[model samples]
Each structure stands twice: as structure tokens, then as C-alpha cells.
Target: MNVSVELTFTPLQNEYEPPISAFIKRVRASGFTVLENPLSTQVYGDYDGVMHMLTKEIKNSLSNIDIGLFQMKIVKTDRSSYVADF
Candidate 1:
């Protein structure tokens, strides 16, 4: 089944956007696409694939940054469409 994961990370610094951008780029490079905004980031892909990258890779990468807020949500998609596509 297809899954969609949404994550929000609030960086503690003003220069957080670059790291967030880099993290998103890394997600895309790993074959998962993302829709990122100032407050949140969302990714859509296979369940395990999306979870692995989000919970493991993304969290690990952001751990080094001074982050203030972090939240994640995963949902099953009834259609093969991106969150932004709807």
C-alpha cells in the first residue's frame, strides 16, 4: 500500500532553511519526493521506504541541528496521489 508521511521541524536558528532544504534534497535523492514549507514537510512513497527515511534518516540528520519542535504523522493513501496533488 502507498503511504504518506508529514513531518514538521522547527529549527532553533535563523539559518535553518538551508539544512531543511538539504534534508529535503536528501529525501528526494533517496527516491522519496517531498513537499516542504516553512512549517512542515511531507513525503509520499512506499510505507517502509517513507518511514525509514523519515524516522531514521531525517531524524538522525536533524538531530545535530538545534531544533525546537518536531512532529510526524503517517497515513495510508487511498489513491496514488501526492498530498499536494489533491
Candidate 2:
């Protein structure tokens, strides 16, 4: 199965950029389709591959921070190539 995931990482501390930036960099190196905006990041790839990468990376991110929030939404299909046609 293939999937798309939207992720938002918010670290509840003063210096938040480092962790978030690091996370984004690592995700980009994950070899998955990654889309980023100011709000969140979207990743598209095989379900297992995406999940596995996220599972490891998310944990790494959390462990580096004292406290943080990881918001995620998993879609049944890949929306990486989606375009607005409205």
C-alpha cells in the first residue's frame, strides 16, 4: 500500500528551530516524496517505508527535546502530485 502523511513538529521550548530543521533535513533524505510549507510537511511513499522512516525519525526528534508535539495525518492515497483545479 502507498500513503501520504502530513506532519507537524512543534517543540514546546524557546529554541525550537534546531530540532524542526534537523527533522526536515532528515525527512528529506528519506527518499520519499516530501512537500513542505510553513504549517506542515507532507510525505508520500510506500506505507511501510514511510511509516518506518517516520517512526525512527519522530522518535529521534522527540528524544532530543524536553517536550514536543507531533501532529500527523495519514491518507489512504498519495497526494504528492496533487494540484488545485478549482
Candidate 3:
């Protein structure tokens, strides 16, 4: 089933923007495109797809950088469109 995941990473200093960009790239490579900015990235894809990308790829990509994932809020949705309902 499709799901919506709202992932908010703790703001890294301006220096970490590069890491964030890299993180975004890795996520995109995993099939979880960004629906919002990396500061508060909102992504849509299969639940497993997101989970795999978030847990496996995101951390690995940013491990060398001084960054941490503060919050990851996931919610299931019956429809793909979020604007009309949310």
C-alpha cells in the first residue's frame, strides 16, 4: 500500500547543506522523491520503499556529515493526493 511519510531532520548548520543535498540524492535514487524541501522533506512512495531508503540509505549517506534525523512521522493514506484532504 502507498503511504505518506513526513521526515524532519534536525537543522544542520549551513555547512551541512551539502550533506542534506547528498541525502536527498540518495533518497531519490531509492525511488523516494522529495515532495518538499530537505529541511522538512515530505516524501511519497510505498511503505517498504520509504522504510528501506530512510533506514538504510539516509543514515549511511549522512554518517560522515555532522547531521542527525530528529523526527520521522509516517502516516498511511488511501489516496495519493495530500492537498485536498490534508
Q: Rank the candidates by TM-score, best first.
A: 2, 3, 1
The sequence of per-residue lDDT tens digits that candidate 3 reaches over residues 8-83 is 6554666756666776677666665567663577778788877877887666755766656557777786234645
TM-score between model 2 and native: 0.98
Name the runs in model 3 displaced over 4 angstroms.
11-14, 78-80, 84-86
C-alpha positional error of residue 11 in candidate 2 after TM-score superposition, expressed in Å = 0.3
Q: Which stretches of candidate 1 lie over 4 Å from their true place?
A: 78-86
Best by lDDT: 2
Residue-level error in angstroms, candidate 3, position 12: 4.3
- Tell me which of candidates 1 and 2 scores higher on TM-score: 2
Q: Which residue pairs clash within candidate 3?
A: none
State the lDDT of candidate 2 residue by residue for 1-86, as single tens digits: 99999999999999999999999999999999999999999999999999999999999999999999999999999898899999
Work out the TM-score per prediction: 0.71, 0.98, 0.72
Report the lDDT tens digits of candidate 1 across residue range 1-86: 78877877666888877776766677767776666667777788888777777767666666768765667887887233534745
RMSD in Å for all candidates: 3.1, 0.4, 2.8
- CA lDDT of every candidate: 0.71, 0.97, 0.67
